[model samples]
Target chain A: MLEIKNLHVKLEEEDKVILKGVNLTVETGKVHAIMGPNGSGKSTLSYVLSGRDGYEVTDGSALLEGEELLEMEPEERAAAGLFLAFQYPVEIPGVGNMTFLRTALNAQRKARGQDELSAGEFLKVVREKAKTLKIDADMLKRPVNVGFSGGEKKRNEILQMAMLEPKMCILDETDSGLDVDAMRLVADGVNALRDAGRSFLVITHYQRLLDHIKPDVVHIMADGRIIQTGGPELALEVEQNGYADILKAHGLTEAV
Target chain B: MGAAVQKSTLEARLEGLSTTGFAPAARKDALARLVAMGLPGRRDEYWRWTNPADFIAATPVPAQAFDDSDEAPVFEATDRVKLVFVDGVFDADASDDLALAGVEITRLAEAPDLNWASGLYGTLEVAGQTPVARPLAALNTAAATDGLLIRATAKAEKPINLIYIHRSEVSDPILHHVIRLEEGAELTILENGPAGARFNKVMEVDVAKGARFHHVRVQGRDHERRAATAIFARVAEEALFKSFTLTVNGVLTRNECVIDMVGDDAVAHVAGAALGDGASDAFLHDDTVFVTHGAERGESRQVFKKVLKHGAVGTFQGKILVKPGAQKTDGYQISQSLLLDDDSQFLAKPELEIYADDVKCSHGSTTGAIDETALFYLRSRGVPMEEARGLLVLSFLADAIDEIEDEGLRDDIVGRLEAWLNRHRD
Candidate 1:
């Protein structure tokens, strides 16, 4: 469902490189987990796939369903069924959460040449999805993410992912800033939306999140490149021993 | 004075007024006051950000009216006694009869005597001359041809709406209105439309003890007209006075509001929302306010928001003053602007003066472009860039818009703001 070939990215304003010669592929109906330590370009990969600015893609291509994703605008990529659940949801003051969701949904629908949802139709779907996430009507009525608790923000992100229903969903550090209960709720929300036509790219720093949303394949990423690919057991191995064993096994030393 | 100050072109034009129906003493006093304070020069501290040259010119450059058929003036959807004015002259044929229980309304042209409004006709305007010179308002008081005289003895059954329509290409309109709310009375006043090519207007209000007054005004819709308006109000003991103004840009528009809380426990709030997106030379919108807390334990708030795009300019000069004996006075003032483009400009001057030791007064002013992080978030969620920009702009002005007391009127004003945003959004 998503393909990346020799993807190289760097900060546009500086001389630093983030992702260097990275390649990954996720097939239909499959879930892939990329576990990496801080500054290993995990979030950068997600941002590059979702078409964020401030990064120059110096080389290679990222395609969604064989269409060049990097060439499309962010909104266009969204219309093309690419969704990125941010690590930190932005707080938009004075913009009601429900209003933002409705606008976003209708905008995507219109961009894809589909009929837009009516207010009532959108409200019904939003309420139903919000209920499972434990988001009350008050949270939907308040400004987006403004004064929201960390768990509430994560749930809000999950609610958006459910509403958009994209072909490729990238959860970038969604487990960060979440307690065990919040993580369970978020995992439940994501698991409920799992379908054959949709794929998931779960990017994380720890193996705990992978336990809740078990990945079909686990890739241990270090220094912007995938060093190993294994099954669900690899996550438990990392959780028990940390990235030191993996780096050593790959004939590399951890930074002092 | 060794050398007489040269009469400005505007003053020369006022010199030709017949003043036939005006009270001689009042007109003379007002004209002398205007002459003493010559038209605010560009170098004047108050006029530094907003130039008065174009508005005070003898022959204002005429502008073709904008076609606003898709958007109706606020309050057109509500039922009220409409006081219509065309080219500064009262239009009786197109207006509802000035008939409402507990309220007495009169046209200034029809009432030639010193009249019930004598005490307030130009008193507030003259009193406002102290910290700075507002020569345009003084001129309006001197040469205004017609306006309304409203008196509310009890709760007004219906809101009084003053609708000004511009029909002539080269019209210059001057009007001064006086409003008095008796003790225990309640009233709401609504004003809308473009008065003329060059318009000068003044509204003086007196809210008595325990009275309540609500004012909502939507300034001219013409993009090229130059307008100067002032609101001078005095709130007495336990009275409540709240006023909100929504302005769309003209070539030059300046609105000065002066409010004095004279009686203990009185409350006053003055707010404005202005949008100016000059496609050509930048349109200018200015809100100048001076609020004084004179009595003990009074409260006053001043909020102003402006949205400027495509090289447009917005300015705010607001001050909150607490008298020496006005202990425990509470005052808050904030002015903010959203600059849509790099060429657009926002200039604000916020001041606070508290002589009373126990008073609490805070004032703030800010100017910024849209939040890029928030914009990206919205766009990533599939909202188009333009729509996202519009939403943020509206949100930037929401706090000030919420100051409107009437829900229906607030909705209508918000609709007008949305329409403006849609037209200007790229």
Candidate 2:
């Protein structure tokens, strides 16, 4: 469902390559977790996939559903069923959350030749989904992400992913700043949306979130590239022994 | 003198006081004081943004009798007590007497020279007298036409509404209205501008100790009309003064408001929203001074928001002043504007002058286009671009309009604002 081939990205100003010759592939009906330390280009990969501005894809292409995703604009990528749950969602004042969500959902629907939902029907669906996620009604009426707690904002991102129901979902540090309860709630929301013919690329620094949403494949990333990939047991190994073992196995560790 | 000089003098006598009821000696004294101050010009600091001299150069035509045969007001709140004035004369048939116990609604000409009017007239200065206002205000004082003077006595409970309506097509007609609220009095006034006429009007408000004065000025006029109105308010000890000025239409309109917090613990809230299109020019200037002399705490806030499109021009200037001994003073002024089209322009200046070391004063001014993310968010929801823009613009102005305590008046102004947006959306 999603493929990244030698995805090389560089900062616009310094031209310093961040993602160097990184490759990854995920089939439909599967979940892949990308575990990386800070500055490992995990967030860059998500941004490149979603077509955010300012990241120069120096060399490489990202394909979603066999379509060239890198060539599409942000909205177009969104319409084409590619979703990136931002690490830090932008706060938009004077724009209600419900209004934004409905617009995005209807926009994707319209792009796919589907009828738009009326306000009443849209409200009904949103309210039911919100109830399941434990999102209060007042939160929906507030400005998008304005004055929301960190966990609440992350939950809102998950809510958008649920509403859009994209074919491919990329979660970037979705567990950061979340309490134990919030982390469980976020994991539960993602789990409920899981199904065959849908894919997820969960990016994180720790293996805690991996416990809730089990992944079929776990990849250890360091120095802007994926150094190793193994079965789900790799995550438990990294949690217990840290990345030292992986770095030593790759023969990249400096001499003491 | 000579025969020709005698003829000229006879002609001057024939003119018989350009207007009526003006005491020559008093008018002369006021005119002398005005002449000394001189007409406010572009060089004047307060009049820097606005070229009062240039505006007065055109010399708007003098006040003339208006034809009252036109249709009634395009919109009027049914619950509001209405007062209509044609030209500079109050229309008795268009006004209803308020038999409310604590309220006194009468014409300025009918009342005795009260101490408040004597003290307020020509005493408030906004960046020195501009050439335009110097001559115009001097002329207004010289002519001294009839004006509405509404008073709410001390401890008055009910809110008194004073509707100053301008019904005319005259060019340079000037109208003056004064309001006084005694200690512990409460008053709410709704002042409406001319529908399709040119005017230069001034209103002076004196709020006494512990009084509460709420004013909402609604300006929804034709685009061809030109107007410049000023509202000067003096708030006494522990007094509360709140004003919301809404401008939806006009060719060239400016509403200048100055609130002087003379006593401590006085609070003032001055908010304005100007939405214009099609060569319309709307400017709102709020100059507030919070003086915390005896009372330790005083608060003043000013917020002005404007939406401009289709070559429209919007300006917001807010200044807050805190005196030397006025410690613990809280003053905040924010001016924001949104320009919808390339041709539209906005100018905002938020000024803060504080002498007291312990005072908290801040001012902010920002001009920008609508939030693209918000816009796309709305459009993606199937709302057309224009509708989305209108909704955002309305939301932007909602902050200022929400300051209005009167729900009906707020709705009326909002409705007119929406209509203006709908008519001007391209």
Candidate 3:
């Protein structure tokens, strides 16, 4: 569902390389987990794939299905079914959450040459999707992410993912600020969206999130490269023993 | 001295004026005040940021009337008493029947000698001139040819819509409006359109004890049109006064608002939202506001915001004053601007003066570009760049837009802003 080859990235404003010679692929309907310590280019990879600014791709290419994702604008990439759940959801004052979601859904549909949903149709669907995430009517009516608790914000992100139904989804530390109950709720939401046509790339610092939405494969990333690729047991192994064993075994301790 | 000052600046500007509105005594007094104050000049402290050369010149710059009819007229869907004016001339044929007015309304040109408005006209303008001078408002009071004189003794059933339509390329129009609300009365005034190539307008409102007044105005349509507008309002005991203005597309514009809370517990709020793009015509918009709290427990708020791009310029000067005996006064003022590009400029001056130490007053001004993180967040959610920027701009202007007390009017203003954004897409 997603492919990357030797993806090298650097800061656009300075001479700082973030992602160096990184490559990964996620097959259709599968969940892949990328675990790493701080400053290990995991979040940077997610940002680069989402077409965020301030990062220059020195070399390499990322493709969604067969289309080159790097050449497209962020919105175009989104229309092509790539979604990134941010670590910190932006707080946009004066823009209602419902308005933002409706606009995004209709915009994506319009870009794909599909019919736009009517207001009534949109309201009904949004209400249904928001219910499972435990988001009430007031939260939907309020401004996007403004005054929202950590649990509410994470749930809102899952609601968005459900509504857009992207082909490839990237969860960037979605569990960092969430409590245990909130994390389980978020995992349940993601687990519900697990279908044969969707792929997940879970980026995290702990294996707690994986315990809920179980990954098919886990890759240990360090020093801008993926040095270890294994199954779900690998995440437990890293959680039990820190990235030190993996870094030293790969002779990346000095780089760390 | 008055004659000498008038001849120096307004020699040719007032060559063909023979407009007599209200009583002779009031008109004569306004003329005398205007002549004494004289036309504003570049050296004047109030006109330092805006060049009054074009306004002082003998002839106005010519502009072709814009003929776009793609969008519906503002407030067209709402029910209102329509009063149409073409280049300062009241169009009797286009206006509705006077018998159908929801409130007591009279034309300034046809008002009787002992008219109710004659006693109130220019009263607030004169009172607003203590700390700073507004010579243009005095000029409108003295020289306006025609306007509407509105008085609401009870809650008005419908709003009064003042529709100014521009047709002449070189038309320079001056208009004066006077409004009065008796005790416990209520009224809402809606004004819109580009009056002419050059326009000068003044509105004076006296909100009596327990009365309420709401005002919403939209300025622009002609890119080359230039305008100078001023609103002076006086709020009495427990009265409520709220006003909001939306400005777009004009080349040079200045809006001055002065509000005085004269009686205890009175409340007043004045806000403005402006959008300027200099890709075609130069854009300059200045909002200068002063709010004074003179009675105990009075509250006043001044909120102004502007979005400028492509070398456009925005300026804001806002002040709040709490008089000595005005204890427990609550005053809040904020002026902000979003410059979309390096060439755009935002200038702000915010002031607070409180004689009563117990009063609560705060004033702040800010200027910056769009929040990049927020912009990216929107785009990442599938909104296109232009659409995302428009959303952020609307959000930035939302606070000021909310000052409009009516829901339908607020939606109409939002529609107008959205249309402007679409037309000026990056």
Local accuracy of candidate 2 as per-residue lDDT tens digits, B81-147: 5667655567778676555568766666665463346554545433223222444455455545666
* DockQ top scorer: 3
Q: A73-178, model 2: which lDDT tens digit per residue?
A: 6777877888888777767765678977886788678878899999999999899888878899999999888899998998998888888888899998999999
> Model 1 off-target regions past 4 Å?
A251-256, B1-11
Give the alpha carbon lDDT tens digit for every residue of B140-217 in model 1: 888889888999999999899998888788888899899999999999999988878788899999999999999999
Which residue runs of candidate 3 sit more than 4 Å off their true CA positions?
A254-256, B1-7, B19-21, B100-102
Best by lDDT: 3
- RMSD of each candidate relative to the true structure: 2.5, 6.2, 2.3
- Rank by lDDT, descending? 3, 1, 2
Against the hidden reference, what TM-scores do the models get? Answer: 0.95, 0.76, 0.97
Against the true chain A, what TM-score does chain A of candidate 3 give? 0.98
Candidate 2 residue pairs that clash: A103-B381, B39-B130, B39-B131, B40-B129, B40-B130, B40-B131
Worst 10 residues of 2 chain B by lDDT: B284-293
In model 3, which residue pairs have backbone atoms overlapping below 3 Å? none
By TM-score, the better pick of 1 and 3 is 3
Q: How would you encode candidate 3's per-residue C-alpha lDDT over A106-145 as one tens digit per residue?
A: 9999999999999999999999999998999999999999
Question: What is the alpha-carbon RMSD of candidate 2 to the true structure?
Answer: 6.2
Instruction: Quantify how close model 1 is to the true structure by its C-alpha RMSD in Å.
Output: 2.5
